[model samples]
Each structure stands twice: as structure tokens, then as C-alpha cells.
Target: MPGFDGACTVNESVKIDHPKLVKLLQLAYSAEKAAAFAYIGHAGSVRNPDEKVAIKQIEMDEWQHRETVLSIMGQYHIPTSRYYEIKYHIIGRIISCSCYVIGWFMPYYFAGRLE
Candidate 1:
């Protein structure tokens, strides 16, 4: 359908075996998997009523993303690990992502950029 956003995309071709393609795919897959787990953990820990609902919705999205990643990996017979070790680097990433979201929206909420 026309004007369906990404339902149809430009058929721009690129080499599938390109290193950059592989790197980007790996990054996206890792982020989705991490987000799924993080949302699950947060959903379990959150106590506020409205926040609980919002978190659950976000968790569902992350779960869907994880499933899509695994489905794509399945085509290549790639293994998707359910038990990967997380290091301190992940904690830093978590903080960074949180900060990014807060930073992006806080200014809009405040109606001005914060200095």
C-alpha cells in the first residue's frame, strides 16, 4: 500500500556479507535481547499502578523484538543465547540509555532546553 510507512521500502540492494551489515545486525540483536530482559526485570520490580501498566507494554514490545531477532537468526541456524553473562559494561549502557531518554523528553516537558 502506498504511504504505509515501512510496509513497503526502497529495494536498495547491498552486499549481505559486508562487515558493517553484520556489525549493525549484531548490535540491534543484542540491544533487543538486553531490552527484553531489562523490561522483564523492571516489570517485576515496579510497584506503582500506572507505571506497572506502562512498563508491561514496553516489556511486550521488547519481547516481540527479541522474538523477531531470534526468528531472523533461525534462518541462518544461528544460536540465540538465553544465558549470556552480563558485565559491568551493560550497567553503564543501562545508565546511558536511561539518561538519553530522560534528556530527550525532559526538555520537551519543561518547554525549554536545560543547561
Candidate 2:
């Protein structure tokens, strides 16, 4: 919805041998794993009961996705990203505990929590 779009055509009619495709696939899987980790980490800080439940559901989905990625990665010998930094970890913990656990007033997710 925001980034520039690019178009590329791949002709499957001809058989092509390429070594770069392996690196490309590995990078793609690495990105997927990073995304899954970010979402799972976000779910940990959800406050509302319903939101927490929804996030947990998504966490399960992320786990399954990671398993699939790992399985595919094993075949290609592609190593996954060891860690993904969650920039929101501190704010998330504060908000989740305040609004849900302790019931203290807390800012919403869409608020200026980017810091």
C-alpha cells in the first residue's frame, strides 16, 4: 500500500541453472522468520482479554509458520536469524501490565508509543 511496486517476468519455458536462487530463497525465509518472531513478541504485551486471546491465537499460527520455515530451511541448509530485536518490548510490558493486570491507566497501542 506504500512502497514502490516492481515487475519481473520469469520464463519457465526454458530450463535455467542458477546458484543465486539459493541465496535469494534463504534471505526470503530469514525475513519470514523475523516477522513471525516480531508478531509473537508483540502478542506477549497485549492487554485486553480478547486481544490477548487473539494474539495468542496468532502466536500459535506464527509457531506453525516457523516450523514450516525450519523444515524448509533444513533442506536448503539455510540458517535462520538468531534474534530479532523488538523495539516495543519495554513499552509493551508497561502497557500490558498497567491496563490489564494492574488496571492502571495506560496509553493505547496506536498512541505515540513508538519511542
Candidate 3:
């Protein structure tokens, strides 16, 4: 390998031990869950069949990302933060409900901003 200095064998697994990095990943995990919840409402609110399918796919992708994040956390022996779990769940539900009242455009706009 170009950057290899024979420090360790390629088969050795690298572990992440940084607290801040782990915390950030935890945040991402929760955010993905929230986004998935929001997408549920997003998909339901839209009338177009194609748009519904697309939003559902996006929702699935968010869930997949959340799983991947959880797997990473497990590797690091990191648990999900309880406070964040509650906070984002509420935020996600709020966004989901708002999607219905405010119409489609604002939700799409806010989602873009969040990204």
C-alpha cells in the first residue's frame, strides 16, 4: 500500500476511539431516523404516484443509513443518547405534521435546508 509503513497488517481492524466523532455519528443516527419519519408523512401527503414511490424510497434509504450508523456505534460500544432520541423524535413528528398543514413545498424546502 502507498501509505503503508508496516505499522500493522491489513487484516487488522481499525477502531474509532474518539469521543467527539462517536457523538457526531450518534447524532447522525438519530437524524436519519427522524428523516425517515418525516419521509413517511412526505410520501403520504404527495398525490403523484411517482413522487410517492420516490419519497418512500428515500425513506427506506434513511432507515438503511440509520442501521449502518447503529452498526458502527455497536462496533465502538457506543449507545444511543437518550436525550437526542426523544428530542429528534418530537422534531420529526412535528415536521411530519407540518408537511400536511403547510403543504408540500415548505417541507421540501426545509428538508433541503436541513440537508
Candidates' lDDT values, in order?
A: 0.50, 0.47, 0.81
What does the lDDT read for residue 82 in candidate 2? 37
lDDT of 2 by residue, 1-115 (tens): 5674775565323322455754454444444444444444455556667876775676566457657766665656655543322333343344444544433223333222221
Q: Estimate each model's TM-score.
A: 0.48, 0.42, 0.81
Q: Which portions of model 1 miss their true places by more than 4 Å?
A: 1-15, 76-115
Best to worst by lDDT, what's the order? Answer: 3, 1, 2
Q: After superposition, how far is residue 4 of candidate 1 from its true place, in Å?
A: 31
Tens-digit lDDT string for candidate 3 (6-30): 8865544456789899789878888
Residue pairs with backbone overlap in model 1: none
lDDT of 3 at 82: 88
RMSD of candidate 3 to the truth, in angstroms, is 4.0
State the weakest 10-residue window (summed lDDT) of model 2.
106-115
Sort the candidates on TM-score, descending order: 3, 1, 2
Worst ten in a row by lDDT for model 3: 106-115
